[model samples]
Target: MNETQRREQLKKIIEESEPISTGVALRYQGETKRVCVYRIPLDFLVYNKYNGRISSRVKAYERLNHELNSENDEDRELIEKLLWESKVERNRKTMEDLVENGQMRHGIVTADGVIIDGNRRASLLNRAYRERDKHKWSPVDVDKCRYFNAIILPQDAGPRDIQQLETTYQMGEDDKLDYNPIEKYLKVRDLTDVGFDIDEIAKMMNESTADIKKWQRTLVLMDEYLETLGYEDMYPMLDRVEDQFLSLSKGLKDWQDRSVLAKANWEYSDADIDDLKVIAFDYIRYEQEGKEFRRICKPGKEGSIFQDRLIWESFRDTHFETMDAIAEESVDEEIAHAHADIDVVDVLRARDSKWKSEISDSFKNNLKYSVRRLDDRMEDAKPKEILKKVRDLLKEIDTEQDSFLNDEGVATLVSEINRMTYRLKRELGQ
Candidate 1:
């Protein structure tokens, strides 16, 4: 139904039903008011495409398939699928509860039938209505599932007001815990696009303005990452890497202001920062997180590849070379020629996994060697411990001419060790 038709249906329903308070007061027009709860037919309302649980999912879909029109059958099915898949177990439990108890809490919707709150409940209501016949259910439960119990907003409500109300109900309260962390950052972006400032968004989300600002910046980093991997605007691709982005974002922030650094041997420029971000982006794409990921880009600390200039230069050169060696084997060409049945993100993700699996040994080996150099240089490094490790390694090597000469790298290192030992003996006056 169009907006006017939906509004008219809602108005007629509200006029016929008496307002049930249920002791719930909704803040509207700068005042708190107890609104009437009317049973609106489920067909009159559309699931919110920007619903917090599936906002990024929808965005990612629309990014590739164009904007979704919920009025369309296929699009509606897709939206419902996203909602259901957002939290399948929780949705199942909610569906069960809905079948048994009906809608315990009233939802909020615009006069034009856009749900602002209780989307999950309304969705489950729709599900119960459709699936009622598949299972044993009470007659009243089955009948009640056909309609949604909700408070319809007044006609004066604008888009900004609807967005704000959605934020207040869905994100400013307990329900926020169910939301994906990436949702807030994208929500901030959406809210800002709809004419809300940092302070207004902070107030709506119940976060500090500084937090909103930081999320905005972090969101840009996330966007850049998507664009870098040929997945521009596919926010769902980041579903598993929120922590990686958070850590990388904080490191980038620290990179911007080195005054906060505790100790550093490197003086980096903006170009260096870009390199750091891109390198970290690669690791994030490969799903290397936590301290393992930090060894590549953690800021204001020693031992990280970027924390030391010499280590960074060598690591960067080798990393670039390694990436270039496999660049031709990436899934981009495959994605380009892929049959319509294959998912692009899945292919790219497979590419990342394959890439990590292929290069993990070399990647980790280089990083470990660099970090070992850093450890050796630190003021607290134990010389005897380092020597003992060297001695143990030396004792295990085969010094036979055939075995030693067969391995060129071992032969080179052994020669260098012999020269170093001779110098040490002379220095000790042996």
Candidate 2:
């Protein structure tokens, strides 16, 4: 519905329908006010594209595809699909509850009928009404599902307050849980983009100001990682790496602020940190995380390649060279040849598999060599422990292939290994 039509419709609904009473308390124009709830026809309301629950998904999808117009039926359907899928199992249970018990909690919408807090529930209501027969819903249940029970704000509601109220109410402790982690990060970014300060965002999200700043900083690094890999603004690539990014962002910040390691020799520059980001990005790209991912650059000498100048330079050069070589080939043909019914997610997954297959071993071997080199500098570290780690890495890789012999990096690394082995043998006086 257009703004004018919804305004007129809301006017009639407010005048004719008896309100269910003041059930919602909201912060409006810097004051707490209780708004009466009303039942409005579903047609008068539209899904909010920037709802925090799926904001990142919507953003990533729109960037990859096109902007969504909520007023358009096709676009509404697309938004509906995203909302439903954002938390599929939970949404399904909520839909079932709506069928059996009706809407227990009221939603908050603007006077012009844009839902501020109940996008998923609203989507589920619409879905339930559309598929009433499939669920064998009764006539009364179907009718009840047709109208949304919500607190409609005054017509003067501005976008700023609306967004703030939406953020506060939808994600409030008393409201729903199970939000996508990415949404919180992107929420801070979006609200910042629209001119909300960190304090304001923290208030709205019910998070501490420090945490809000941290999330924003982490989001910046995430964006840089995406842009570095030519996947700018595509957040689905970060599906399961939230924890890793948080650690990496903190690590990078620590190094930048310190310039030198806590107890190590090498001092780092901004350029060096950027190289570390790319190296971590590659490891993250190929399914490395936790201790393995942290060992790459966790801000200390104990297994960090950047702790020593030589290790840092060798690792960064080897990593970037391998990465550039991998990026030399185009995957557009393979993506284009995917099955017609294949989805973008699957296509991206296939591309990811292709990348991991081609680059993971090189990334791993280089990291292992660099890590061992760092350990070698630790005179207190046991040789047997380091050698055991090397043996494990060797067992995981096959060196007998003809392709291995042909690889210049592999040959050079093996030569270095032989030289080190000769030194150890001569020192033993065999």
Candidate 3:
């Protein structure tokens, strides 16, 4: 058949075949014979998009042929040699050797093509074909090879189908594919199977975990940074930028100020930053797309420490105020009790001597208003009830006031209250 006729016939045959079908044909290249075959869709052709340059079917053939012709002496000696024997053997060998040795190569195919399903023998054949230069090789030998087989699939296979098939193939093999390298290299940290326990994967790659953690924190601040520059989508480009940051920050490890890192113009020039901002904004337009105020405040560890200390002091002062309120309430109740008991004179004497002497200036000032109110209440109450109220107020003061005061202050307050209580009791003959 003419070349055009042959192509037409191949297409027709492919159309007529079932969803997953196979066929074998011969094609003559000048005086050479070529084994042309249709493989079922069940076969897979794995190719790395970043690296593979060959067309899909051709790449698949090359990969398969390379495997068949592998020079590893041990692979050449498998005894079972069943239909799937080579594939099973290869998987075992790959698991035991390639995986542990980390010699496996990864690549993606840009096109869809026929692939051998877990057939190591077929892979070996394909590998051999790949090793032979197309211009120098004869197809007659391939046609003569009875062990070669192919499974064909429809051209319009869905991605889901391909993924399902790939997963099946992976499961059939004993060797586990190590996706960690790509994942780790892309992100400095990855959460383990367990929740919250983030594994510092970059550390496994000989990177510093602390630095990686710092970078992760930086990532959290990326949105803010991007906002400051009117940028967006800083996530996808994180890997590249992080590397740049690492290089820039390497010498500045001792610098606790993040501003130093932020100010340091490493790989990104002012112009580049503008350009990157535009690119990021375009890429991540879905998120809030502008510079944020916080992004400009790139504080380092020291800055964070300073901020924390300020907050702590503020909280301490607030707590002290709350404690003062509690103490004043207690003192008021005590004064009112003394007034009702008709022991106002005694109470006044005790308060001037004991309360004034024991409590600090701050505590005394807070108690002043409440003490005045209690003294007023004591004037209108019966003497006996006033005394009881005074005792009760003193006990409440001892319990609640102690919590607000410092340890030494509390001890002094308690001692004074005890002395007053004793003196009052002796005077009342109770």
Candidate 4:
């Protein structure tokens, strides 16, 4: 039989047979790849949004069990209310679409019925069943959802198996959608927190170990920085801005290294962390600007600090005094002071307005310093070696001269060559 016929056969088997009890030594019968449908009671499944104060599936089950067994009426009521609301919010859209189409896909569950996948669907069906009698206001028909559909796994499936299967079902499927950065980061972090080794997670998620570590590190540091700034509760502010946080991470390490190395010490100083805190706050504020901040921090942009490693080095080595503005007592105080005069956006824009000129000036000064040193060396060089070097330099100059399409560019190159030639003659006593 074809696929649809097989599914119909499975549905018939489910309807004719009694519900399979949990903890049974269930074995696969008939074909191994056949889809099996079971009408599981709503209480048998669990909801795990992978967020909130309860961080893991185990924790969610614990709260659920507490609600099921609690002697205190108030505690049970509160937990029940929370579960209902959370499930409704998460599953409402899926429920609406499924009912409208009158079709549902297969969901996976363990024998003990901790939903490995499709908790939202199960939750919606459960809600429909619970409210079936309250027909005066119920949106979903209770008669249609007396039991939830699922493909129950064997009794031996453990947490590792569940995690692996969920990851596969969510990420490995051809129809898989790209998760937003924050969701991806949180999922990886959650897996790590639940005792999955980095290499194991890398293999499971099809990501490099370094990539996994980078996400974890960025998340950990971002949380610490948010907590430092008294906005730990506001961590969702980082959603969709992983690049900014990653850039801050790199910038923080660079700044710390420079500050510590300047003191001739290998350990991080308290002042270094303090400076980092301020910069971290600045970075988050910049991220808040959304598109404008992205424009300034765009990787591979013309004069972006994030794009140009050399710009960061130049700022660190030469323009260190410019960052003194961020060296305040606290991020809060610095932010307040920043906004006390001009708005933060205006302040940032003003700095961006000067960035090109500042970078140009710094570049010219460094070039001038290099030229002076080269002049000193040329003064003492052997004439033959000098002539060979000058000839090679002239060849390079000629190659570049072909690309100088503008009149101003040609004039500048000719003038520079003349100045260089005059210097060479003076040095060689010509």
Q: lDDT of each structure?
A: 0.81, 0.81, 0.35, 0.51
Candidate 3, residues 96-119, lDDT tens digits: the string is: 332123222221111243232333
The order by descending lDDT is 1, 2, 4, 3
C-alpha RMSD by candidate, in order? 2.7, 3.4, 27.8, 13.8
Per-candidate TM-scores read: 0.91, 0.88, 0.21, 0.49
Model 4 lDDT at residue 292 = 31
Please write out the lDDT profile of model 2 over residues 247-285, one tens digit for every residue. 788878878888446655766678887888877887888
Output candidate 3 Cα RMSD: 27.8
Q: Between candidates 1 and 3, name the one with more favorable lDDT.
A: 1
Instruction: Report the Cα lDDT for residue 141, model 2.
Output: 75
The C-alpha local distance difference test score for the whole of candidate 1 amounts to 0.81
- Model 4 lDDT tens row, 49-164: 34221122223334323333322345334334444454454456655555455336657766644556665455566555565565342445444565566776765666666676
TM-score (C-alpha, index-matched) for candidate 4: 0.49
Candidate 2 Cα errors over 4 Å, as ranges: 174-177, 300-303, 327-341, 382-430
Worst 10 residues of 1 by lDDT: 326-335
Candidate with best TM-score: 1
Ordered by TM-score, highest first, the candidates read 1, 2, 4, 3
The sequence of per-residue lDDT tens digits that candidate 1 reaches over residues 14-108 is 78777655556889866798777888889999988888888888887787677998788888888888788888999989888887887788899
TM-score of model number 3: 0.21
